[model samples]
Target: MSRLKLALFALIFLAACRTVPPPAQPHSGFTAEQQAVLRQIGFQPKGDQWEFGIADRFLFATDESRLMAAQKDSLAHTATALVNVGIVSARVEGHTDNTGTARHNEKLSLERAAAVADALAQGGMQRNRLIVRGLGFRFPVESNATPEGRRENRRVVIIVTPEAVA
Candidate 1:
């Protein structure tokens, strides 16, 4: 075959072998690092907006009014990007310090998830694409025996699943 024809044949063969990237793998669930984020958020997602609380976890609490502060902007961006790429649905889980009663922790976790979800929304995600849940003291990253452990236990976690995006 002529050089040009040979080149064309090779190109066609390569193109035929190239398949659409397999539909992205379904999200298996949260990773260890992401679970660490839950330790930071202090809650977990059971479904949509409901939040459960974990007493023995440490979570960072910030104001909803300033939810988009630079510190969390990168996370917001990443989560949004994943959603935009049709890779996953965003999950915001919240938790709280064990400084309060079980009821209080539950409520606090829900608030924290809502706060993060709000930040994500501000970053351009549709509200329907967000799932928020709070787990109060039901799941602990560390034992709540000591003050430090308690501090570590209060947190919120974000879990993204690919199935949502598909």
Candidate 2:
């Protein structure tokens, strides 16, 4: 009877011992000011979905040269703002009007995204801090049926987030 009681007590003690996962580490990237912008922009880290943005003025440009300048400036500002807060990495997504062919638009969108990424790098962002993507006309914010709306739809969005620090 004594042996059986000791065995049960040992089993219970062993069962009570458990290994808990380490707590989530603090995010290490953005400055305080930039962090505020991220919070305002609704950047949540729980899921795969992240928020990005595009400028209204950039879409109104008629020539590629004009578009390039606006895109560069926009991305630079975006990166600066994010880095200031704590963003260590970002993804730039480019969108365009439906007036062009799919292939042409696709290439143009990628170029636009790359241009933005370059601008971000110039603004003190690191080389590995960015990822560029071009969605073309497939993901339009506004209807492409009208010239005005199409212009508004052509843009690049920057998604910001901090690097993983264990």
Candidate 3:
């Protein structure tokens, strides 16, 4: 995409997100340092997991699977912090809105998760410690009837644990 298109896309996404209410900030059992990392890296800390939404912090263009430059930087920071705080593993889950075929959505979601996991690896987390999954659009945080709700539904939710999950 050209610079103008990219800028316009970001502006449009940001404007669209402005009307949506922010999700509640939920803290998990993570140490203070870990919590701080999550916040600083743009995740809304939820107990046992955190939400990295496409709203305000947009990750990709509609149906676009690659990570934006800023997203990579944020994930890198998160990965470093997770390592420092002794988080052994994470299930990096990718999600999408209900606008595409289930199969395509599932594949896109998985690709997005792998992208996130790759970013984490670049930041210091071991690749083997990360598991990626695509839940598709089946598990939405909001209704799919409206634009704002759909925007909120496009997200990456990470579940961190002390031990690796099979």
TM-score of each: 0.56, 0.63, 0.69
User: Deviation in angstroms for 143 in model 3?
Assistant: 1.8
Residue-wise C-alpha lDDT for candidate 2, range 1-166, written one tens digit per residue:
9999999999998888966679986653555566567656545443433455343334534324134565567657766766666665777777788877999888878877777777778877886767888888898888988987788767777665555312
TM-score of 1: 0.56
- Mind giving the per-residue lDDT tens digits that candidate 1 earns over 30-146? 555554444354435454321335442225642221243663675566555544545345667776556667897788778877777777666677667777888877877777778
Weakest 10 consecutive residues of candidate 2 by summed lDDT: 56-65
The best candidate by TM-score is 3
Q: lDDT (CA) for every model shown?
A: 0.60, 0.67, 0.77
lDDT of 3 by residue, 1-166 (tens): 6999999999999998887778877646677877676666566655466655344343445687888888888788878877887765788888889998999989988888899889989999888888899989999888989987777777777667534555
Q: Against the true structure, what is every candidate's RMSD?
A: 12.4, 5.5, 20.7
Instruction: Please tell me which model should have the higher TM-score, number 1 or number 2.
Output: 2
Query: 2 or 3: which has the higher TM-score?
Result: 3
In model 1, which regions exceed 4 Å deviation? 1-58, 61-68
Distance from true position, residue 30, model 2, in Å? 8.5
Write the candidate numbers in order of decreasing TM-score: 3, 2, 1
The clash number for model 3 is 1
